[model samples]
Target: MKKLLIVSLGIIVFILLSLPWVLILVGRNKLHDYDIPQREQLIPSSDSKKKVLALFPHPDDEVTVAGTLMRLKEDGHEVVLVCLTRGEKGKSSGIQDEQELARLRTSEMEESARLIGVDQLIISDYPDSGIEDLGMDSLKKVVLNLILEKQPDILISYDSNVGLYGHPDHRLTGKAIEKVFLKEKGKEGFSPDRLFQVTLCKKQVEVALKLSSGFQRNYPENPEMGLPQPDFSVRTQPYFDRILQVMQAHQTQQNVLKDLMPFHDKVPAWIYSRIFDREYFREVK
Candidate 1:
């Protein structure tokens, strides 16, 4: 009985130690699993150039779709990035003063937007982490004015359903964008060809929650909530290296990036591309 117990414990330890490696090996070869037909080009083929505008509550929020934006630039379309806040409330390694931190983050966002080939980068002073407090009408009006000024052919923002992970700021940003889009779309001088909301596959969300305890703790109810399903995915494999550069641009947010995407720097580019080759989005109808 004693020997049997020792063997059982040994087996359990071995399995626990081997699980991650086994998963990695399997993931490296399973790229075909993600090769769905619905994974299509983000920009439709056209002779006329189009302007793409993306809005997010924070500076680093653009990281999720940076590759897609790069792709837009590569395809000869204009890309505009509007960050509603400078991420003044974000975590900083050494900066203690909120104003100084905001400045640093804004600089970082400028570098990131430059790397993504954004033609116009707009940073607003709306309080970070306090977007919802501004009220929906005010938010809608601000978004509407931006849309009117940019006259972008495509509009992008966070999903209205789960806001990618139930963050209140993210949710409010999406809500504000959707409200404006619904109310003013197709109107003269305010028409957008498409409205796409950034989202994650259910499986991607599950993996995120499982990998990062911070994500789980912050969004404890996320698993129980329904997220907007991805209508299509943008193939970003070609821009994977540029995406890494974009992430690296946010030096102050390295800790947050490491927490969320732990394997980004550990694996080779090819391997990382295999896993994160596509950015998912839901076209708001």
Candidate 2:
């Protein structure tokens, strides 16, 4: 009986030790199930370095594309990030005051941008969770003015359709960028070569909703409503370690991040990167 018990205990320990690797392998296979495009075919080719600008509504919203941004920096492209709100309304364990939370979140974003090697980090004081109140014309004007000042070769933002789970601020940010794109399109010197909207595959949305109640609540009621189909995907495996560091920089938003990526802090970076090796984007026509 003693020998049998020892064997059983050893078996359990072996399983426990092997579980993380098992999960990582499963995740890698599942990701491969998606019909992702070839990177060479989809990524634009340019002889000279280009400027890339990303606009998002809240501080931690940048996390969605952190890896891709880092890859862009490594490719010798100039990357700028514009955050429209400080994410003060976001829930944090110890932070109770909105003003104090705003400051903390702003600093967190600054750290994140630094880690991502962004050339410029622009934080605007638009109301948290109240971007729609700014009105369509007002928001469009703001986005247009930024584009004119930056003259970025590529523009990035959330998908206007479902906002990657129907966050109002996220949707509005995308809308504003779309409006500017429409206004300046075909104008010789004013238009960007492409506008890429960050999006998740249908499988990703399903997985996120299962993992995070926050995502479930923010998602649209209509069953058909979701992000547009991805036009391309960026392979972010090379920058995955830096991506985790960027995420960690947003300390104030750890609760939400943990909910979305439960094993983020627990798993080895190599394992984590295998699971989240790519980010999808839709090109706005």
Candidate 3:
């Protein structure tokens, strides 16, 4: 009986150690299982040459809407990326010094912006993971000034209310943008015609939660997590190659990329293309 019990314990330990590899295998297979034909619906048309501004807290945040940016550029609209920080405070191996990491990340971000067809890139001085420490009034002012200067027709950012598992920087940057939008939208002076908050579809969130606890453990206990009802979605599968290229640009964030997107080299190109298959956004204005 004791021998059987020891064998069972050994089996459990082996399974626990192998669980991550198994999950990645399952995730890759599941990517191919999605019905691509059913997801090929056309995105809404926008006027030619419209200006767009995306505000986010970190370098890689732009990946969330990479395909949308590609489409906007293809449509002849001017797209700009404004990141709140260089993501210098992100997780890093002991090899690279902090300064070196920041420089590498900044370069990666610029390359990503270029790949995404961003005509302009504005990186602010706010510290990574420390946007909350920046006063609310200051945060709003910084974003407001950019909106006024750019005079964009569209603004996009993370969903402030939920903030992709409640990262403080993500939450603060988004809330700042939302506050600016609410206060200035249709005001006598300057404002973007519309504000769109990017969100994870329920399925994506559920998958992420199941596949990795990194994000799930950090999600705040907020009812707002359930709130971002998407008003529209962009079928980004057509621009899949570009999205993957953009993600690859941020090589310093390989771990993050792996976690945020269940992609691997072994997966077929068609299946991996589903990485940025759909991007959901809710119109706040």
Candidate 4:
């Protein structure tokens, strides 16, 4: 009886400790790719000078499309990065005050933008993590003004319908851009030719979250987290180093990433090299 009891306790401990990985395996079993037709592969001509505009909610959020933006710039296209907020509400590395944190984040963003080869970086005054609280009409106006000023050929942002983790700021930023996009699209000589929403694959999210830590609140293991079906997926294997450098520039968010990612510095080059190589995008309009 004593031996049996000991064995039971050991089994229970083992099961409890492995529960997270078990859940990850279960979630991954449900992964399935959609049978969507492939869109034309984008190959920019070296002389083509397409103007691209990218809108994101925070300083670090730009990392989502860093590789794409870098490729566009290298191909002779101009790219502009419009950050909605300074990431004042983000987890702090060492700063105590929100204003100081915002300042540091802005500096980091500038450095990242320069290195990523963006032509311009625009910073908005909206409160960090408070985008949805603002009136939609007002947000639309702000985005519209920028779109009118820039006259970009392509616009990229997060998908409002299905955010990576349903972040309110990300959803709201996408919503505002959608409204402005539709409004300007019908206007004469004004709308962008294409609009793309950066997204993640279901299988990729499942495996990544399994390896990550401290993401329960942000990236719950919900089916809605991934794009229903991606319209296009860009392979960015060649630009992995560029994207990593861009993410590293957000010094204040380094600790936060490390907490979420299993690798030291929150990003192991080999792991992300495989995971982020394929970037998904849905062309909404």
lDDT of 1 by residue, 179-235 (tens): 888877788898686899988776676677778765675654745565677777888
Q: How many residue pairs clash in each candidate?
A: 0, 0, 0, 0
Reference-based lDDT, each prediction: 0.82, 0.84, 0.76, 0.74
Say which candidate scores most in TM-score.
2
CA error at residue 91 for candidate 4, angstroms: 2.4
Worst 10 residues of 3 by lDDT: 33-42
lDDT for each residue of candidate 3 in 11-96, tens digit (9 for 90 to 100): 99999888766765565454433432322222345444678898998989998889888888877778889988888887643434
For model 2, how big is the CA root-mean-square deviation?
3.6
Worst 10 residues of 4 by lDDT: 32-41
Q: Which stretch of 10 consecutive residues in model 2 shows the poorest summed lDDT?
A: 38-47
Better of 2 and 4 by TM-score: 2
Question: lDDT of candidate 2 vs native?
Answer: 0.84
For residues 1-285, write the lDDT of model 4, one tens digit per residue. Answer: 999999999999999888755654453343324453322233346435788999998998877777777778777787889998999988658677999999999999999998798999999888997887788988888888888899898899988765655677887788788777876786786858778888766665665566645344566455644444577676666787877788788889987655433353444565446544556788875
Question: After best superposition, candidate 4 residue 155: deviation in angstroms?
Answer: 0.3
Local lDDT at 29 for model 1: 43
- Over 4 Å off, model 1: 1-25, 28-40, 92-94, 220-224
Q: What is the lDDT of residue 269 in candidate 4?
A: 65
Error of 3 at 161 (Å): 1.1
Best by lDDT: 2
Flag regions of model 2 displaced more than 4 Å: 1-22, 31-33, 38-46
Candidate 4: misplaced stretches above 4 Å? 1-47, 208-215, 219-226, 258-272
Q: Could you report the Cα RMSD, in angstroms, for every candidate shown?
A: 6.9, 3.6, 8.9, 8.4
